[model samples]
Target: MKALLSSRPVLWFLFLFNLVVAAVAPFAVDGTQGLVTAAGMGAVSLGAGAGLLRGHGQGA
Candidate 1:
């Protein structure tokens, strides 16, 4: 778990995936659908950032 959490590649992949989702969310839907999609994308980014911050301060 520590090894995976510390990996830069995994973090980068998550960041890129969230970015792509946010980019496409507006055009792919409307009304509540677009709002929900955008919220989900934001949540993923916030969660990933929080996880990275927490992992950085963790000690063995």
Candidate 2:
């Protein structure tokens, strides 16, 4: 379980999911607020992924 959590593939999958969210949010939700919220979420996800990559197996 610890190994899986630190896997690069998992991080890539998360990034890809965020990309999809960025693409779909505009059409699925109305108003600028949704986009801003999604962008904020994306930034957090990106930061998390970066941290995981930087720390590598440290957390595990």
Candidate 3:
């Protein structure tokens, strides 16, 4: 369970999930824009994935 929680796949999954939520946030609001938020979330996810990949390499 600990291994699964710390896995890169899990990290990536969470990041992607956040991105998806950000993308859909605009529709939830009456007049809010979601593109910028989505873009920011995407950037964060990309960075997280990259960081996880790098950490995995160092451990192996």
| Candidate 1 vs candidate 2, TM-score winner | 1
Greater TM-score among 2 and 3 belongs to 2
RMSD in Å for all candidates: 3.3, 3.9, 4.1
lDDT of 3: 0.70
In candidate 2 the C-alpha lDDT for residue 39 amounts to: 91
lDDT of 3 by residue, 1-60 (tens): 867756777877867887676777677644535666766777877776776777776653
List the global CA lDDT of all models: 0.74, 0.73, 0.70
| Residue lDDT tens for model 2, 1-60 | 967755777777767777678767777888997788689768867865795679775743
lDDT of 3 at 5: 53
Scored by TM-score, the top model is 1
Model 1 CA lDDT for position 2? 69
Name the 10 consecutive residues with the lowest summed lDDT in model 3. 28-37
Model 1 Cα lDDT, one tens digit per residue, 19-50: 67877887888778887887888778677776
**Alpha-carbon deviation at 10 in model 2, angstroms:** 0.8
* Candidate 3, superposed: residue stretches over 4 Å from native: 1-14, 26-32
